[model samples]
Target: MTLPLIHTPYAQVRQALLDHTEIALLDVREEDPFAQAHPLFAANLPLGRIELDAWQRIPRLDTVVVVYDNGEGLAERAVRKLQSLGYQRVSLLAGGLQGWRDAGGELFRDVNVPSKAFGELVEAQRHTPSLPAEEVLALQQQQADVVVLDARRFDEYQTMSIPGAISVPGAELVLRARTLAPDPRTRIIVNCAGRTRSIIGTQSLVNAGLPNPVSALRNGTIGWTLAGQALDHGADRRAGEVTPAQRAQAAQDARAVAQRAGVRHASLADLERFAAERGRTTYRFDVRSPEEFAAGHLPGFRSAPGGQLVQETDVSAPVRGARIVLVDDDGARAHMTASWLTQMGWEVWVLDGVDRSAFTDTGPAPATLPRPSRPVDWIAPATLAEQLANEAPGQTAVINLTTSANHVKRHIPGAWFVLRTDLERALSTIPSAKRYVLTCGSSLLAQYAVEEVAQATGARVLVLEGGNQAWADAGLPTAEGEQRLASPRTDRYRRPYEGTDNPREAMQGYLDWEFGLVAQLARDGTHGFQVL
Candidate 1:
């Protein structure tokens, strides 16, 4: 049965933000369109991904969720899906995206605008020290006593880095910086793909009161390239183990910073109490490296490496005003990450004094969800290949429900890329066939859509056994590029700093955007950010 859609006015949403109450303003469009424009605090939970992500992102069933789309007729569908998944308080943003604009709301461009804006605010308030790429390069040329720390993920560091930078991702900076540069006179420079992590990471060291002078590599690698400086590709340098004494000192320093920033320390009992508060949304994150998280972690804690957590808080925790509990075995990482969270207006706590044995769970954090009520028909890769080879030209319709980018990168040779939300309409454009096959990155998403597709088409519907990955692993031929597209490539937003070939204007414009975030934050007046 379809539930009557509840309409929430723009005033109510804005009031929720200003009042510092829990509100999840979800943009239900794909990433590309969402990135082009969204409210400052809006989180992108695309329509195709509601079933897979809604539960994990908005943990509470009663959490106020207002979903919007830019006149694409997706918000109503999203509301229905959320209702089906047990979201009790789902509502449509009255008048949709245009309503927010008409109500004089600020629409932010690019993803993670809240965190990026916070970083800019921190830099503006704290005057976080930074050195331009050219100046840093000159210092390197002069053999200055400096150590460059890449604050991005290890894979990102491996892709491109400064000539002599080491991969000490944002969260590791405070815990490992002293060990990386034992000499008190050594100058430290931190960087990321762009500005936010660089500012946040550098400020973290300074906030911890690290002795050696620290500064961000202004605008990060983007600045390096813009300044006609070269980047070292495939660099493997990473931070090593910290000595006991170093760990102790780092812990002490980080704790002091956390305290100053009003970060609370929670005991195991306190954590249990927080968990019991079903009325309040509490997210428990193991703020450690992915490898460390996979090795061992407390039960119920999700893996969100500290740096990325701070950078992508909207993605991780969409419900603003929710409580956050960060866990880490190491004394420093959690505290350092918590310090940033506190400043970002999160009611954050660091789990303290927990015995190592408490970490019973092992391997990657499990993604648990309710199984589909109806059984799904699945086709193995080999069987699909045989059917494709033997069947008539229009016998089977293989619809790829993965991201457009992923579909373009690699997919079954004759597969048509279609948005799961647009399946019925997209199918009308495809040739009639005897059977239809559905697949995504892992077929997890496609499995959820089996009933919907079967209902809409009244055709034999089957999911690919393991999706595209299985097809490739079976040594089957794959095709690339935009061969057949039923929907625009809007699933994933192409980041300005991701690849090597971004236009100079776009890069500069990106940097220019960062420069103006502070003003935008002021205009919005809802962000409860504080800098220590």
Candidate 2:
């Protein structure tokens, strides 16, 4: 049965944020449109991905959820879907996106606005020091006493980095900086793909009271590129393990910083108490590296690398005012990460006294959801290839439900890229076929949509076993490009700093946007950010 629709006005939403009450302001539009404009706290959930992500993101069924769209007619459908999925308090944003504008709510552009805005605010309040890319390059040429640390993910550092820079990631900066540069006189330069991580990472070291002189590489790699500097590709330099004395000092400094930022510490018993709370939402994360997390981690703790968690808070914890519990075996990383989260208005806690014995779970966190009780019909990749070869042009329609970006990169040749939510409309556009084979990156999402497709078309539908990966593994012929797209490629937002081919103006524009975020935060007034 469909639940009654609830309308939550912009004023009420703003009040909720100001009160530090739990509320998930979700923009149920594709990422491209979502990145264009949204409220300060709005997280992009995307209407089509509700089933796949809703359970994991909004874990508590009773948590209040307000979904909106900019006249895309998606919010109403999203409410119904959430209700079906057992979410009890789903509502529509009263008046939608335009309503927020009508009520004078500040709308922010780009993804991860809360964290990015907080970074700018930190820089403004603390006047975080930085050096231009050209100056850093000149210092390198002169063989100055400087060590460059890239604060982005290892993969991002590998993609493009300052020549000879080491990948220390943001959370590792404070814990590993002293080990990387033993000399107190050594100048440390921090960078990322863009601005936020650089600013935050630099500020973290300064806040932690590191002896080395530190500064952010202004505008990060973007600044380097705009200054006509070439970046190193496939760089593999990384921070090494810290010595016992270094780890002890780093832990002491990190704990001091976290305490000043009003971060709390919780014992395992305290964590259990938090978990048992009936109405509140609590997110438990192991704030360690992926490899460390895979080796062993406490059960029920999802792995969220500390730096990425701080950089992508919206993606990790969409519920704005929820409680966050971070776990790490090394005392420094969790404490340092908690300091940032506390400053960003989270009621965050670092788990204390965790030993090796607490790590019971091993390997990566399982991505599987509860499978359907009814067995799903599936076709092997080779068999599907044979059927396609023997079948007529319109005998079978292969629908790919993977992300638009992945589909464009590689997929079974002739497969139509279609959004699962729009399957009914998509079926009408494709030529009538006797059978439909559905596939996604792993066929997980595709499995959920089989019944819907069958109901809509009354045709035989089967899932592609192991989806696109299995097809590729068999050395079957594949195709690339946007050759057969039934849906628009708006699932992923193209970052200005991602590739080498972005226009100079866009890169400069992105930097300009970052510069203005401090003022935007002032206008918003709901963000409870404090910089130490």
Candidate 3:
């Protein structure tokens, strides 16, 4: 006597999902079908990925997967793929998803896990609180008790944050929180556009055993906007800085802590002696985020993301076996990075830059930029503009090299970012067109971007001079922020191409390159192109 065929009726499947919180109910239907209707607990895995990218979507093969589709042939294929992949607890909802609805089961709409929901979850268990728009306004008016920590990049923070928020990215929280909130009585509040980082940031302090209570700005800037609060950038409101006395104390405290943590504190003489050793393979790491790294970092130091550097130091520096010197404008980053590296068994040193300029001891031959009066061998913006004027429509590719925030904030008519940190992932996703213009905050970065592209694949490369700042400052028109996720291509990690230097020419090189890219496009065929 055989039992019923072990069939999972729609009701049973629904019950199974509700019974196990860990179970993942996957909607295998195409977007249209899922948009129309899907199980309340289902996460969309799109039918196509169930075969190829399933492993990435679901890391644990044993995760209970109840797959379904809208009466299409896709679900069966998805199930077969899961079975082949050794996903042990895989099952099918006896009938396609429609059957669940037919049986009076509930359906969910627009239920993608949004950043806001995640933000709330992060705030809830993490003791993260957000000042509502009214509260924030009142705080501003009352000269409040809370300190807003803008957990975005320094540049993003510079561009915008709550009126009094300070720029404190996630990675820096563990290191800088102490200085910012010295009293522990100071209420610490973290914020990010959507969530993730803000939530993680607030939790870091709580996890660090810091006695201070921490909270995240509920919903970040978006939430602030939703609540009709005012936002500002450093342009109008600058980030808080440690005063001279505070800076001195911070430096002293940092040196003592660093020494105790096993990080070698090197004097200028010590650094010189180390540099004198010929043949010794030593790599310098500027452990700040790329934005800060670009703003100004130690001479000859390469940018290595702090988190990745901590996790995979050997990969980032194969000379990992070599002596490593870490530099940072403030002792916080240098010490934090050094502490982590010391634990990894590397010979690490922290250069004391509190009193000395990190760039002061450049060997006799200092790093230099091209002279503005230097002969213009590269295709100048004028030349590119002239040629572009002659070229037929659709014959050019537009590669914008501006920062994502800036690109979103404003950009040349059709420019795109050519060197995003996630270039490989973004390549397939970016639009393929005829011409490409490497862009950035300034033209030098654009040129640096062009060099990167040249090394990878040969395509038309045009560098914008002076970059976006010049264009905007010149009173030129610009786009106002990309409202959605941009092609990953534009999000490349740019270790080079900073804005401190001036082009031999171009009064407004930065802004012209980014905002006036369309004007540059008018010139297409000028010769003598060298990307330096």
| Residues 1-532 of candidate 1: C-alpha lDDT, one tens digit per residue | 7778899999999998878788899999888899998999999998888888988999899999999999998999899888989999999999899999999988899999989999999999999999999999999999999999999999999988999999998899999999999998999999998999999999999988899999999999999999988899999998989999999999999999999999998998998898788779999999999998888899999999999999999999999989999988878999999999899989999999898899889998778676875699989999999999998799999999998989989999999999986777888888888889999989999998888778878889999999999999999999999989987777888898877789989999999998999988888888889888
Candidate 2, run of 10 with poorest lDDT:
366-375
TM-score result, candidate 1: 0.98
- Cα error, residue 294 of model 3, in Å, equals 8.9
Per-residue lDDT of 244-263 in model 3, one digit per residue for the tens?
66555544554554565578
Over 1-532, each residue of candidate 2 has an lDDT whose tens digit, in order, gives 6678999999899999999999999999889899999999999998777778888888899999999999878899899988888889999999999999999999999999999999998888899999999999999999999999999999999999999999998898888999999999999999998899999999999999998899999999999999999999999999998999999999999999999999999999998899889888999999889998999999889999899999999999999899999998879999999999999999999999878898989998775364543469999999999999997788889999999989999989999999875677877888778899999998988988888788888889999999999999999999999978988788888999887789999999999999999999999999998877
Rate residue 462 of model 1 by lDDT.
95
What ranges in model 3 sit over 4 Å off?
1-144, 158-164, 168-184, 192-236, 239-245, 252-262, 267-282, 286-298, 302-324, 328-333, 340-347, 352-378, 387-532
Question: Each candidate's lDDT (Cα)?
Answer: 0.92, 0.91, 0.54
**Lowest-sum lDDT 10-residue window in model 1:** 365-374
| Alpha-carbon RMSD, each predicted model | 1.2, 1.3, 18.3
**TM-score per candidate, chains pooled:** 0.98, 0.98, 0.42
Of 2 and 3, the candidate ahead on lDDT is: 2
